[model samples]
Target: MSAPPRVPRTRPEPVAPDPAVPEPAVPEPTLSELAVSEPAAAEALDAHEEHAWSRCDPWSAALRSGRGPLYLHREDGTRHPLDIERWCAAPDAADRTVIERCRGSVLDIGCGPGRFLVALAERRLTALGIDANPHAVARAVRAGGGALCRSVFAPLPGTGSWHTALLVDGNIGIGGDPPRLLRRTAELVRPGGTLLVETAAHALDERLSVRVGDGRGVHGTAFPWARLGSTALLRHAEETGAWAKAGEWEAGGRRFVALRRA
Candidate 1:
């Protein structure tokens, strides 16, 4: 009888539900997906160590003296001198020639310090310069030119709409893949648009993984780069099927090729 009474008085306690587990975080947008303008996006990706040459202060003595000790250490154990002075200097006769060739909306790939871009702007041409080096971009902006710290391989503002595209300052060696770079330029330039590229004077086509060095201790990370002569550039253009040789010229001991869409 007492057990029965106790059971009747007893009541079960309520149990609390476990807090719901939070869902996994969503992944951030990629560089392409951001769809941001070149300048803004470029600033986000800017890294000083990635492009040591942009910082001209450390190399001021060498750059100003036109005797830069900067070099590119190739995989073959050879060191190729990099012309930091020319790149940092104002536009010369040869640079003017390249600028004169630029017509309609111009897109300068690897536009170091924006010398050509500034010239284009002075002429009132719709021009945009893109470089991966923030310091270079800053210099360009300071000079009152439109420039962005961005890579040519990244998403651009006017893909396939640019009337003229440039790959000067040995930028044809970019990424160490001439064919790929040519194909990319083709994609960037519209039908009948022109692609002006600078090449080595010799007839060699070589690709090497290299790093930038000041010969004083400062060095950058290794990157793939190529050096193609006029002949090799023409061959690459033919293989791409997106371009045809329009003209060729030499300036300041450097060679250049002009290609137009088929």
Candidate 2:
């Protein structure tokens, strides 16, 4: 397995366009703009699609889908229909309440553009977000939020230190290594901390097994991402003896299960 460390340590350059691909008009979107302006999000996503079609990482462009937490690059130097908020997990009022109940600093894994962190911050919680994709992290940082351009499975600056950890967007299977990923997430959060792992309560087959390609693509198994439903995930939580189910909720089209120390 050539899986790179999931620690938030490695620094990579943000994705840019190739000469073969002409840049499309994708003006950056502010968090507020993205939050309320669905039309703008839709437009930006279309531009991303265009960029992918232009051969920016051609293989990934071929794998590009208009859905998921992925942002694609098209041939016209534009990105595609971006799924700002994915289908299964939604950071709605329920998630907001759970975040408010957090005891200390919070860590949001797979924080894309820091939208969730920004929302968490509004509630006066110290939150941090990390992602493997430099572009996403950079966007979050540029938008004035605390986001790291690194992987979640890698060593964290402050390990076993946070009171709350977020693993929404079916992050339990990050890097397609479920057990290691769960253990690593546990290591990052304090013993009594809560790791809010979200997935499809009904369609979980896609969340358990991941199949990432290269260092720049994503293709998880078709499982619905039910970390809560998996016996292995349950075992991982028990073996750690650090977390137990604390909170859970469902909205839009997903389910969330928050695990904390017993």
Model 1, C-alpha of 249: deviation from truth (Å): 1.1
Q: Give me the runs in candidate 1 sitting further than 4 Å from their true place.
A: 1-67
Candidate 2, 11: how far from true, in Å? 16
The digit string of per-residue lDDT tens for model 2 on 93-203 reads 655655655545668887755667766665555567765544454556554557654456444555666667887655665544555666778777766667877654554
TM-score of each: 0.76, 0.58
> In order, what is each prediction's RMSD in angstroms?
20.6, 14.8
* lDDT of model number 1: 0.69
The candidate 2 region of ten consecutive residues with least summed lDDT is 33-42
lDDT of each: 0.69, 0.50
- lDDT for 20 in candidate 2 is 36
User: Clash number for model 2?
Assistant: 40
Clash statistics: count for each candidate: 0, 40
Top candidate (lDDT): 1
